[model samples]
Target: MSGPAPIHVVVVGSGLAGYGVLRELRKLAPDATLTLVTADDGHFYSKPALSTALAKGKHADTLVTTPAAKMAAQLRLDLRAGRGVEALDAGERVLLTTGGPIPYDKLVLAMGADPVKVTIEGEGATRARPVNNLDDYRAFRENLPNGARVLVMGGGLVGSEFANDLSGAGYKAVVVDMLSHPLAQLVPQQVGDAIRDALAAQGVEWHLGRKVVSLDRADAATIATLDDGTRIEADAVLSAVGLRPHIWLARDAGLETARGIKVDATGRTSDPHIYAIGDCAEYPRGLAAYVTPIMAAARAIAPSALGTPTEIRFPPLSVQVKTTAYPVVLLPAPIGVKGGWRKVSDGSDGLKYLFEDETGRTRGYVLTGSLCEERMDMDRSLSAAEAEREAA
Candidate 1:
């Protein structure tokens, strides 16, 4: 006479979503068998800090707050690091990995996004570095010497942050982008100009309204040729164009996907037994890449996947830009809303603006400079429905 086997849960990722669900699941089902599988070393670090790390003088190993061994022991989990999923067998409720087949009663997919890849025709085309993880950041830091001239592609948030960080640390950072303004996709023109000016005052060279067409090696330095017929020489090159979710794995396994894996408010995918979260999940509005949304998803997923129905909550949260040269906090207006941003106030250090819709309703807002302290008050003024509708 043997007792019944414990329920097993398998998670395919080692990022915030995977660890988040496990931390919450342990609170609900302490005795449930838990396992975590990842292709990397499974070290825990703040992914957002990678852009601003140069000013703080943090190495790759220094960025890791906890290692795989510690996380597994603390949660009493079976940790499978340095392993990748070759294929997913949804019909049989099993995962095909490099090690072997792993059957599970429930599965969680927390696969994060990858940098959008673009090809450039040149000999040094292989020199474009994108730091999306600890290992990537480690290599980036090791390759650059103090005061080295670095060429940065894209004027988005990540790119701007890195430019500010590098310039603040005495690195000669030159930025090239097709957009005429900084953060053209996220912020208003006023805010974008403010970011550009602030970083420019910090020694960051800007080549806006232009893009690198090709990269070639020149002795010890790399030469980046611009479409505007300008060639910039630098010791290193970095790319931060955009991010794309990991949707192929789910799509190939016969799961619904659009932009990212489609999931309900409770984080449940097309298959009830499997749930998706983080950058890889597409909510009703869009993919919420910020921290607060993913934490809420994990909380609901832990209970919902364990036979309990729990809906995730999307509160009005403010996204703060980590650039030290300029301070920014914003909540973008909802998509398809007939609205325009109007400058409200100008302070000594920054400016404040509000997004008003056609009907004169306040839809969203962005605050810069000294007015950034009003973020919490402004954030609460917006409704949850409109706030959660932020662009992916």
Candidate 2:
């Protein structure tokens, strides 16, 4: 009798999450057939590096580590670049793409998220650019002239990083956010204040507790009107508000979705044959958008996608804030947990803060500047604390 055909795995997306899954799957089943379909050029590039590329003097073109053709050949994948999956038929196990319908034994949705755009009125509102992907970064770089004044909206991680990069690149960066301080959601007020001071010293102007209501065209520049009637002139505007997961694909296909495509610990969707990972997948905890989570999910889901069931267990992960002026490491406290940040240490070099719950359990920690060295120890403590809570 002839041997059964090799199981085909179809991965939709070419981002770090999608490729990470493919890498893991290849290791588990070298002979299995794999295909990658992406809407973009399918080049391998670090999404995190985009925020710091300008400061490092790296061109947009150089950001792509590997082109699609080379990646496909290296990984033995059937790469389909620049094609979108218009519809997904879960019952039939078929994906309707720009090329044609493709069937697979297992399907992975790593579609990723889209940049959240804020609504602004006036003439130059549409001119506000968001550098979420490589293509967007290229266009932003091309339009940015020497000594351009950039108006950055949002004071979160991406916005702060871009502001610092812009300042380092010899551009005037004015950051506007409705929040009282930068990284309000990640760090305490004191920590945010310290970072704000450091970035300000590097020529990053802050417009805290304010929102850009409108954008109008000036002589050759753009005028941004704040909520408080303050007008600022800039050559360009960059929005780093946030990201909304691309869930229409999974939702339209009748898969359960909330903030993102709902998947179990094994990355399996409501339909067992289909799976989701990366920024697009929402686990029990929430959306794991960072690289570490993506890698962890990939390792766990690879076996399950290949017929061997495996569930992922996430460890305490630290989020590193990329502001060279004052490096920050944070382990965010669990949502809805009763806790308050207590100062552990504060010195000229840096500061440290610990989150303690009502039961006197250390839930999370934050370290900045030279204090970042204690990340490993702090992470261990956080894990131990969590374990203690679970046992109780």
Candidate 3:
């Protein structure tokens, strides 16, 4: 009889994916020796809450419902915080870290992503802030003066959310970006227009079709010079350009990586013993950046990690509008899949856009305002289409 199977497991990263993996593993293999490692403070909070943090009057500390100590205690797991991974030895199944090398029967990389950096010339440019983690938020909060003039760079989701939250927090917020509207690439132009109008009413200024060329320190304020030579003075500048998957380590370790670390359906790397998930892992089909897909991947990978035969296919996610003001819902067309959008709009108050493929089957949809009434029908249609595709 085989002695008790190797009981060691090492999970990297402390974000949602890492924690979720641990949570699922504990339920399935309670006797397994589990060790979690992370490079940052191990506080646990819903990261999606960061989008509306300031507007909800919540500080980073308040967002953390479970501290790292409590999490480790509750799960009966060993937790390592503020430790950076040095390298991966796939052949040996060892993880090299600042603490030391850890050998594991299974290894999970939920490494997450890093904020993209933007470079601008000027004195305070080097000091410009990007809030990617709790420490960064704390640093920004400490450095920001009361009643400060804040200039946020970018017009995407994070930038728009930051602008709204900061303005709601009583800061004089100004957002500058090259895009014509907020969430320009993600949502349709009509929806963008509505959001722009709503945000403008809330005192968020839009600097569309403009880029900051330089940032300099001017006495107590920072001066941001646009490409067109227009100068805007602000107390601080917050850069929210976007995020790129942290894939350098994976790449250096000789793992296949593109926009993200490439992983199979089971989150397995090129080496079967190692696996990846969350924002850091990229599916061959495309990047699914939302939390829903991350959860799906984790659920599928857990059983496989425990040596169970589980073949699960990720289903297209049902997107719901979390913002109460606009009351919009969308199921975005999957990436790499071509489709056409059929739209019917009633000014800014009601709008519906359906994305259908070559066969006239509904693959995705977007509904806003009163048009949300057809969501059930749209979902049913898509579900039937998916079923048919599976059967075929």
How accurate locally, in lDDT, is each candidate? Answer: 0.88, 0.92, 0.80
Residue 277 of model 2, lDDT score: 94
* RMSD, every candidate, angstroms: 2.8, 1.4, 2.3
lDDT, model 2, position 72: 96
TM-scores, all candidates, are 0.95, 0.97, 0.92
lDDT of 3 by residue, 1-392 (tens): 87887567789998889988888888888888889999987888887677677667677798898999999987787898888999988878888999898889988889888888887887778766778777777677777787678899997877877777777777878889988877676667777777677777777888888999999888878899998888889988889889998888788888899999898877787767777888898886667767777787878777778787454466666565544445567787777667688786665457887777787777677787877777777777777778888899
lDDT of 2: 0.92
lDDT of 2 by residue, 176-274 (tens): 999999999888999999889999999999999999999999877999999999999999999989899999999999999999999997999999999
Superposed by TM-score, candidate 1 places the C-alpha of residue 67 at a distance from the truth, in angstroms, of: 1.3
Order of candidate numbers by lDDT, starting with the best? 2, 1, 3
Q: Give the TM-score of candidate 3.
A: 0.92
Off by over 4 Å in 2: 385-392
Residue 88, candidate 3: Cα error in Å is 1.1
Task: Write the number of the candidate with greater TM-score, choosing between 1 and 2.
Answer: 2
Better of 1 and 3 by TM-score: 1
Better of 2 and 3 by lDDT: 2
